[model samples]
Target: MLREYLQALLFIFIAEMGDKTQILAMMFATKYKMSQVLLGVLIGSFLNHGVAVLFGSLIGGMIPANVLQIIAGSAFIFFALWSLKEDDDEDEEEGVRKLGPVFTVAAAFFIGELGDKTQLTAITLSVDAAHPFVILLGTVSGMLLTSGVGIIVGSKIGDKIPELFMKFIAYGLFLVFGSMKLYTSLPEHYINIFSVSGFIVFIVICSAFLIKPIIDKKKKGEKSSYQKAAMTLHDYMNQMKSNFDNICLGENKCGHCEGQNCLVGYTKDMIKEGIEQGTITNPIETDSREVWAKKAFDHAKIVDSLKFTLKYLMDNYKDLQKRDMSNAIRNSLEMALFEETLEFHGDINMYLEHIKEKNPFIMEELRKSL
Candidate 1:
């Protein structure tokens, strides 16, 4: 029993390396707290493996070995095709879901592991080993260990790993496993060297044809979004500059000033007032209104264009946050534009500087841009 459990553990552990379940676990860990995700995976895996072992023990005892081989072989082939068809967008969608950790992890794991290789391995281990309970425990232990490693280490390393390489490796494993199953079903005389070669070629060709275009399109879409974001940021800065120039030139009336107060002078006062009220504790660290005015003017046309562009883009894009564009730009522009507005003209305690500092990225950018 001990030997059987150890072998089962070893087999399952090896089988699970780079498996979809482990990949899904790592993906989940990236967005959710690790402890909650691990717990959910453990619970789901224990249940799935336990059920597989129980059924394997009972079913294996009744089915003829040859029939089982055929069924398993067919299943492996179907799984290989399914893996090729797997949607690459799942990781992105999962990352964005706002579901609580336990539900997210549990749902992802449960869907990911349905008819997965490790589950099949659990059934196989039960049939081969005398001790079904020990086999089940060993399989679960192995899965937990492998998946835990994937969650803890894989999440960090996965970014460095090439997606194409990972996909190829996964596909290769499925092809190998599927071919082996098919070979087992063939009669000894009919199994020729060419059969194995042909099977591998077929698997590779099918996988490449199915997944290559999808991968290419995804890459293209990402590149387009990145370019659009960069252009949008550039244009936004320009619009801010034009607006600043107009305000400072007295084209826009400063409510408190009888046509004498300039926007730049007014902004300087606002910054000073903000610091005094504790709303802006670090005015000295912020970029000067003059520097902001220069950049804003330089990018005026682009900035004007961005107002309309960003509105449409933001309305259509799900994750487009105003903060993500460059909070520093937004804050500086806001301070520059509204400095002369009536609400902030008096000796008000509050200032926009304090609100901007709350965002570290914006604060850092503001300092750098200054």
Candidate 2:
């Protein structure tokens, strides 16, 4: 019983890792608190997987255990192939915001999982299990854990975890476990060298057929000039942000005046005081004001460049499918540019005031700096 439960948990956990629903969870995190998202996931997954397990348990009792294993194994092989298919950008959150955070997430998730791969996986795992309720529990736990990961990736970590890598890992696991099940469940005479080799060749051919399109699409996308430009812009912004944050020597270490008090202003004041006291003759040579001024000017140019690029991308988005600018990536770019604009246009106090309710720590740090 415990073995079956663990198997269900492990299978569901890996299957959910890079799936579209996880991505949706990440997107939802941008709009709601982590705790509310987690609670909704738990409730939604429990209901969805509970129904799936019930259906599968009934099917299990009707069929022979060996037959059920064969079916389950074959289904997993199909799932491995299905994983290569790209997910559609379905607008799952249409008009659901009025339900509040927890209910909105719960409703969205429940609807999303109606015929989703994870729900199908739960049914598959439970079809041969002796304890369907145990499978339900395991699958629900898997969803909660994976949703937490997605939320963390979206809100705190950003693009540190590559979605493509996670997809391949999930695909490989499904393939391996599926093949193992078939090997063990088949008759001993049917699993001889000749048959096994033939099956292996078949799997390889089918996998190649499924994988070739993805590779070809990527290759074709690489030739797009617009794609290259967008990628370059993205990389430049990330590097600039990193550099700006690393140079801070303030108490909050808030990235060269990302807080209320500006380090540039402080440095300028100190330089002025030094000159007035006759301790410094050349302000240019006595302080870093010149360097800071140049950086500020350069930052303005960068912001202007980004605004142009973003506007072009938005206007020509339909014509540039190869650019692969996902909503998450675009949103990240927009937010970064917005914050930079706030800083550059001297509207940071307004921006901070808007965010003060959501992130009180920034206000707290501002007080400390003052």
- Which candidate achieves the best TM-score against the true structure? 2
- Residue 165 lDDT in model 1? 49
Pairs in clash, predicted candidate 1: 235-302, 235-303, 238-299, 238-300, 239-303, 241-296, 241-297
Give the alpha carbon lDDT tens digit for every residue of 1-370 in model 2.
8887788888877887767777767756645678998998888888889899999988888998888888888888888877766565545666776898988888888888998878889999988777889999989988888888766644444344444456677789898988898888888888888998998898888877876765675555322221222233234334434433443444443344433123334323433433244232322222322233222323343334334333334433432221233222232222333332212122435634643654565444433322
Deviation (Å) of 97 in candidate 1:
9.1
RMSD of each: 12.5, 14.0
- Native-referenced Cα lDDT, model 2: 0.61
Best by lDDT: 2
Error of 2 at 359 (Å): 41
The parts of candidate 2 lying over 4 Å away from their true place are: 154-158, 216-304, 307-370
**40: Cα error in model 2, Å:** 1.0
Local lDDT at 347 for model 1: 19
Per-prediction TM-score: 0.53, 0.62
lDDT of 1 by residue, 1-370 (tens): 8987886676666556555666666655544677887787777777888888998899887887776776666555655555455343234335535667876676666666667777776786576457899988888778778778776666445434444444455455555665686687767866777876876687678877877764785565332221222233224434444444454434243233322133344434534433344233323214343333332222343234323333423322433332233333334444443331112211112322543444444333433322
Give the lDDT of residue 200 in candidate 1: 64
